[model samples]
Target: MTSSRSDTRSKIVDAAERLLREQGPTAVTTRAVAEGAGVQAPTIYRLFGDKDGLLDAVAEHVMATYVSAKAEIVRAASADDVDPVEDLRAGWRAQIEFGTANPTLFVLLSDPERARRSPAARTGMDVLRSRVHRVALAGRLRVGEERAVELIHAAGTGAVLTLLSTPPSDRDPGLADDLFDAVLRRILTDTAPFAEDGPLASAVALRAVTPALDMLSDAERQLLTEWLDRAISAASPVTR
Candidate 1:
């Protein structure tokens, strides 16, 4: 596409994302996105084909950003040698930190409707999941092929989402660390030395947020902690 066309498309996708985050997919009309983007309604159709097309573009854009970053973190965490469980903990923390830092983008990336509508978006998450599966199979973690990988992903993502949506005063910042340690301790080797370490451990502790944790606000941090509490409290079949 031409430079001006690409720029307009980017604006439209951004506007659509903003609308979806604010009002949800049903409210993100093409005309509305166009108006919000300062483009003509017909131009939206010309560029994206229709409303579904626009939504697909927007979802793909956000999902690309989220999945790519997540995959990188998982890949990086997999390289650590302290303990497989600690590496796994590092991976989980990275994932939570990412989602909590970008709550809107995380939701947009995980939207079921968007997955059904966009192959690129669906495949992006699939790639990330596949990496986690590989790690589990490699014995870096305790997840088996049956459903553990999915469960772990669900738990982690749900935890982060709940935390991001909750109020600061209602949360405890230390819960996520505690919950992560508990989960990893359950799945990782019980006899491992790194498993006993707490927040000070370099292997499991998020010393650096990869890029930076500075993007997150105080409220977002509080919400993330609340979500972690819920995730940690949830009863699982494994526990049963």
Candidate 2:
């Protein structure tokens, strides 16, 4: 978009988000947003296609902030030699805080259909996948990398939603921490496992580095990945 169009889009999104924050989703009508943004209603249609499209942009704006923070956390791991598990925890806490603090925006971003199509939502998952890969490389993840990512994602989402559902005064403040610990216990080893402990941990660690195994032929890489996947999933519980 040109500078003018980009500025116009920003103004409209800002107005819509302010309405969403102050008065909930219903308050973000095109007419209201146009008036707040000092633009014609046709401008909103031109820029965003429709209100649903405008809301998608709103979700993207909120999720882009979230996903950028998450990406920085992932980038810091390699740059600073941070512990991957601790990095995961930091990201988890950030996610929880974001969700609980912006309940309306969180609801918009977390809607499954919107998430499926949202670039920012996918970027957030990519950050988590990277985080999980770091843990697997450290041999601290006792499950497959994909499985670990799913577990963490599910647990974190559930924790946020559960917290949001309760009245703040009645909510258990420790619940998020406790749930993270529980998930860690389920998906991690006390220490990096020895070869004899089980195939699961070893498989996960190897899986994390498989793409960088330059010596392997295409067929060999494919075969090795298939074997590791089978071994990892053999005992893994299915996501419901």
| Best candidate, TM-score | 2
TM-score per prediction, in order, is 0.58, 0.92
Model 2 TM: 0.92
Candidate 2, residue 158: Cα displacement in angstroms equals 1.3
TM-score of 1: 0.58
Q: Once superposed on the true structure, which residue ranges of model 2 sit more than 4 Å away at CA?
A: 192-198, 235-240
Candidate 2, 63-124: lDDT as tens digits: 89879977886897879999988999999999999999888878787789988999999999
Error of 2 at 230 (Å): 1.4
Against the reference, the lDDT scores of all candidates come to 0.61, 0.86
Worst 10 residues of 1 by lDDT: 199-208
For model 1, the superposed segments whose C-alpha errors exceed 4 Å read 1-7, 18-32, 35-38, 49-53, 74-84, 116-143, 191-240
Tell me the lDDT of model 1 at 148. Answer: 45
